[model samples]
Target: MSHEVIRHATMDDLDALAAIEAECFPPAEAASIYSLQSRLSVYPDCFWLLANGDTIISFINGFTTNRPDLTDDMYDDATLHDPQGEWQMIFGVDTDPRFQHQGHASTLMRAVIEDTRKAGRSGLVLTCKNRLIGFYQRFGFIDEGLSSSTHGNVAWHQMRLTFDEA
Candidate 1:
């Protein structure tokens, strides 16, 4: 692992981020370039990118909303983003295939979690497949059984990590 830096996204990263998403997910499950553009424009601060030198290798992008669950509508509509919302809804955790297993995704995820906590969010929410439940649980996200979302036509399980205010 050569010195990697995690930072918030910018419009300049749109192409690289879209390419990574395509590589990490199937067309049906991946976010379209238009969708990515909308998100970046609306909530760039919520998108964390992990870079090795000048190359972006992984990222975690999401939006804040009062809704506790991630719905398919949120993926395409940046209008749903609320900067002061109570929940941070993680839409994707993308890593370049070559960067997998190097903990890049984990590093970005931790950054997002800490950033959200510091922002006074009530919690963080995400939807993942069955195989990823354990992976998310390691981050303290509790599986809330099956999700109602049919995003990408795939079955998803809702996971949440709540933060208690002192």
Candidate 2:
């Protein structure tokens, strides 16, 4: 098995992606199996997974959007997907515990950022907990304090990485 960066995730990768998600986030914060199906079938280009020797390592997935804000609906609403949307909205980034601190997550994010730019979109956006605001800043994501759309009833900090600046 070879270790290399990959472009897109296939449906066969669901189980591995799910395993990483389970370990990294609570069930409430993680996307569901149905949501994964939606992502795989409808937005394959938006989902990406990295592997080491045929074993899944880390991944990041999201879709392009016309809207600037990342509302809760984007997570569960498959019908709301717009493949041609202007704003590249990222949903999640997860890496296996053993693979942490190895720059795998950052590698996947760079791919996503490049894809968003090639698509000629306006920008990339995401929402994270307050504690993670600084973490994203390191990647050049600017925090837009107090996002309006609440996820799981918690306050989310909206982050944007414009095509021009990021």
Candidate 3:
């Protein structure tokens, strides 16, 4: 692939990121432009973009969390700021349909994993649907079993990747 595949998202990436999210997820799972804007403003370090030449093919966005648990409340309430937190909570990951099966998500995910590790943080954490357990395991994320908190009423699997494991 000729895609450069790495970039720190800026305010200008909002539209592309939102578009990817809309295409890859259900309506409720999609992140709004305003929310993406807010996240970029506070935690640009947690947002990453993967580009194919000039077009954005995939991206991952998240925030820093003090607690180990990936809670549903963190999805909305923006005032719960915690930049000094030890854990990174990945909120959304999406790849444009055209780029599916090309390992773009894995490429972007590695960037986030390294970003968290280089920050001296403990590690990165994320939740995905139950069917995706093995998909994350390939990247070294251990299945922590079932998660209690449900987003948009959909059950999600809580998986974690520790820096020590890498």
Candidate 4:
């Protein structure tokens, strides 16, 4: 396996990030360029990019908030991001289809989990379809069952991973 470098995102990555989001999700589920820009502007540090050489192949992006659950509002409202918040709310874990099954998404997810723990966050939260519940559990996430998010008018399940202090 080739080593992919993980780093924080920047304004320069706007186009690439938007492109990747489009490729990874359906139109109804994808984040718009404007929303992505807003997130990058407010909390780039929370957006982790996994790159193979200079091209980004996968990423895990989210914002921090006191809210324990992942909500639809957090996806569009950058103001909801609280840098000092206790929980990390993941908005997306995207990987280019060409790179699927290569473990890039898992690798990026682990990096996000580690970074969140180091930031002293109480836990990490996210929402996904039932199909992905098992996938997330491999990383210690506890499935909280169906979510209230009607963001894209699709059913979502909320999952959380809490960290214990050493």
Candidate 5:
């Protein structure tokens, strides 16, 4: 991981971010370029990217909200972000196909958790498919059972990593 840089996102990253989102998720699940742009403009600090030299290999992004549960509307609405919110909502954790399983995603996740904790947030929340529950669990996230979110029309389980428990 030497020389691999992790930093907050920028408007310049919109193209690369959108491309990675397309490769990492189904069409219905991927964020549109426009939405990505809006989010980047509104809350760039919440987006983190891991780049191996000049190429982005992975990234994690989301917004903050006082709302404890993740809702579908949060996915498309950048204005929903509240910088002072208690909960940091994770919208996506994506790794490039060519770079999967190389610990990039895990590295990014750790960074997100540490940053959120430092920001004085109460906890971090994310909704993931059943297959990913264990992956998130490794970071101290507890499965809160099925999420009410119907994003992408897929069943998701909400997970939380409370700073108090960490």
Candidate 6:
């Protein structure tokens, strides 16, 4: 983690972000370049990236929404973001395969949680495959079971991390 920086994304990060997304997920699950662009343009502040110098290695991105549950449509629709929404919806947590197991993702997740809390959001929501339930749970996310999402034509489990009122 030496010399690595965690910061909000910019449109300049599109290529690196897309490359990581492709490496970390199958085509069916990976977000398209256009979708990434739209998301970046719409809510760049919601994207947190871990970068070593100019090269991005890991990122956690999502939109804020009042809706309590994650659904399929949210994946491709960047316009749905509501800046003052109660919940931060995590759309993806991607790390470069070369950088996996190095704690970069965890580092970014912690930043995201802290930032979201400071923003006065009620909580965070996300959907993950069965294999990742424990990883997110370590961050205090509670598994809400089968999600309504069919985003990649695969089963997803919804998870939520609600912060205590201040």
Per-residue lDDT tens digits for candidate 2, residues 73-118, read 8887767778889998888888899989888888888888877788
Candidate 6 residue pairs that clash: none
Look at candidate 2 and tell me the lDDT of residue 116: 78
TM-score of each: 0.97, 0.92, 0.92, 0.97, 0.97, 0.98
The order by descending TM-score is 6, 1, 4, 5, 2, 3
The residue pairs in collision within model 3 are none
Q: Which ten residues in a row have the lowest lDDT in candidate 5?
A: 157-166
Residue 63, candidate 1: alpha-carbon lDDT: 94
lDDT of 3 at 107: 81
| Candidate 4: tens digits of C-alpha lDDT, residues 123-164 | 999999999999999999999999999978899999999998
lDDT tens digits by residue: candidate 1, 90-151: 99999999889988888888888998999988989999999999999999999999999998
Q: Give lDDT tens digits, candidate 3, residues 1-166.
A: 5737588888888888878888988987777778777877777767788886779988887888789988888776555658888998888889999989988898888888877888888887889998888888998999998788777778888999988744
Instruction: Give Cα-based local distance difference scores for all models.
Output: 0.93, 0.83, 0.83, 0.93, 0.94, 0.94
lDDT of 4: 0.93
TM-score of candidate 1 versus the correct structure, residues matched by position? 0.97
- Candidate 5 regions with alpha-carbon error over 4 angstroms: none
Clashing pairs for predicted structure model 1, backbone only: none
As for lDDT, the candidate ahead, 1 or 5, is 5
Model 5: per-residue lDDT, tens digit, 23-136?
A: 999999999999999999999999999997779999999999999988999988999999999999999999999999988999999999999999999999999999999999
Candidate 6 — worst ten consecutive residues by lDDT sum? 1-10
Total clashes, candidate 2?
Answer: 0
| Candidate 3 local distance difference test against the native | 0.83
